[model samples]
Target: MSKEKLFKVAFMNQGKVYELHAREVNQSGLFGFIEIGDFVFDESSGIVIDPSEERLRSEFEGVLSTFVPVHSIIRIDEVKKRGNNKISDLPEGANVTQFPSPIYTPGKGKND
Candidate 1:
């Protein structure tokens, strides 16, 4: 028997921090994105349901795979088991921000 791999991916989106578990995490073919697939959630908690988990489940429902920009990704780790996935607001004055791509520089040429 072989054990499966589970990944915990954390990222920032719209000023909120998101953490989730997935079976697949790989570098996307796109220029600057990561591919994630096979979301995992526990549904055997019985009568009680966590709002955060429910929210995440609904948000990812019907989603086969998702791509997140490399810069937005905070961290990725391989875990032995899945945890409760949730979204959290960025702390006050948190230094987290969307990575800005350099499109142009407004200085004189290097040769100048």
Candidate 2:
């Protein structure tokens, strides 16, 4: 039987780290973005409930796809199986920096 591919994507969002699984991960057609589709959540944990994971699920509920900034992405991995999706707080003194926007101003016209 042919198996479908799965990927785990980790990215920074609003001062937290979001890690989730999807069937598709690729460079977005939109500039400076990564496209993710077919989000996969744990269906085996019927008796167990994780609030953080639930929050992540609801946040992306009904969304067909999402674009994340390239700089915000920490890593993407093709995995043999799915893992629990979760959000995490950055460790103390963590050295990750957010991507700076507005690298250029198009219409300032030399500032007079």
CA lDDT of each prediction against the hidden true structure: 0.89, 0.91
Q: Write the per-residue lDDT of candidate 2 for residues 1-112, one digit (tens) a residue.
A: 9899999999999999999999999889988899999999977668779998899999999998999998889999999999889999999999887967853457757774
- Residue 90 in model 2: shift from native, Å? 0.3
**Over the stretch 1-112, how does candidate 1's per-residue lDDT look in tens digits?**
9889999999988888999999999999886789999999887968988888899899999999999988889999999988989999988978867867843556798775
Off by over 4 Å in 2: 101-112
For candidate 2, what's the RMSD? Answer: 4.0
